[model samples]
Target: MVCDMSSDIFSRQLDFSKFDLIYAGAQKNMGPAGTTLVVVKEDVLGKVSRKIPSMMDYKVHISKGSMFNTPPVFAVYTSMLTMQWLKDLGGIKAIEEENDKKARLIYSEIDLNPLFKGYAVKEDRSNMNATFTLENENLKETFDAMWKEAGINGLNGHRSVGGYRASMYNALSLDSVKVLVEVMSDLESKA
Candidate 1:
């Protein structure tokens, strides 16, 4: 039931009320890959006849305020702290704006750079995952070394794509994108 409305196409296409539950791993756009966020409607449960495990029951968790079990204590706590940080930094809207800006900066560079092309189609490109690869095979090693030395980590594309991917999630700042762009520019200039 939890759809990622974060995608560009889902912006106007979503009707949030239709979903009984909405959940997202805070790792992608929210935080490091260890926290999950859940939002559920009060009356959606008990619609099915199948027996539910105690740990698998949403009603139980909801009834207990999501602390039904010990839970991933530190992970949840950190997620709460991150939420507070977001609030202090002018809330989700401001952070989303920053994320959009970073995506734009990275995507614009990808488009203009002849040596690289995005893995996803123009419309399907993910804001959180900027997947691209070197147009020239010879440049892979150089590009890899350059980016790593420039203090850019986790820019490697998924194995299926075998190229470079700059994941500009919410926690990643504009400064990181700038560093990546500089690396790209340097590589292109040398190429």
Candidate 2:
């Protein structure tokens, strides 16, 4: 039940023993969007006596080696490539540091900017998706216009949660975060 919602997994300070399962979408920190990851203790598996359908059952998938009806072919292939890329880039430890640095810059900018405010509680806020909004509602139009002008795309927030969300996934570098901070700073000066 304990989810480390942070982007940089290495920055997680959670006590993993407390959780029954650990789940993460590969798209965010690991790989592309199509693949999902679940790691559960072997002892925790057979306790659910409910008759779960084949595809819906983790035990079945685990038994079948995840080749439950051919599986997501392209997603698995891409995921393999991403894992190799991670290995080549010095693995999880190195990537975690880079991700942390990127998140810090973006969060720092959002925190310091008078006009902008982050969405989540400080501790619960995701380092991957830095969700925030302009305090002056009138500035929404202006901010959208500015990001468009700067050739920045996908900074828009999810409709479920109004405002802006800069998703700095693993592939997104510190340089990209710096560029985004510069944009925020520029906008703040104008405001």
Candidate 3:
């Protein structure tokens, strides 16, 4: 009964047999925004006590071959291209390894750096989004400037959670992760 929509999707593996319904917003690990890829065990629809709106119902979308309305063409096409690229790279199995390496590199710094603290519990840390915060809030402005100067962007955390979030998606390379780590380490040295 867990409706998990945490946005990892393609970046992390999940057992579909364990989930009656799983939804992923394409903007995260997939393509652009305005599209959501959903997988559901159809039987679960039968148990819904309330009526679902046509636009929001999975059954409708499935029945129409996902053409229930004017879909986001750009997002859908880009998502398809992303999937093809991933497949060519030996699919999820291969990308998962690269992702693990990137996560390890950054998390190692987050752990070793005295000026920073990881936001997620060590065991529950996400491979896609490694979140961490400053040990000294006073250093926020300085750290922000430092990372930006290092050519890092989109390093901000989710609006609901204020800190920093390093997104290690499928296409992000080990070298990119290294640059971020270097910036973090630089921050530590300067602190």
- Collision count for each candidate, in order: 0, 0, 0
**Which candidate leads the pack in lDDT?**
3
Error of 1 at 92 (Å): 1.5
- Estimate candidate 1's alpha-carbon lDDT, on a 0 to 1 scale: 0.76
Please list the C-alpha lDDT of all candidates, in the order they appear. Answer: 0.76, 0.77, 0.85
Clashing pairs in 1: none
How high a TM-score does candidate 2 get?
Answer: 0.86
Residue pairs whose backbone atoms clash in candidate 2: none
lDDT over C-alpha atoms for residue 122 of model 3: 93
Ranking by lDDT: 3, 2, 1
Candidate 2 weakest lDDT stretch, 10 residues: 4-13
State the lDDT of candidate 1 residue by residue for 27-71, as single tens digits: 655555566666678777877699999787888888898878777
Q: Higher-lDDT candidate among 1 and 3?
A: 3
lDDT of 3 by residue, 1-191 (tens): 44555467777555668988888788777787887888898888756789888888888888999898999888889999998988898877888888999999999999999988999999999888899999999999999998898888999999999999998877788998898888888878887
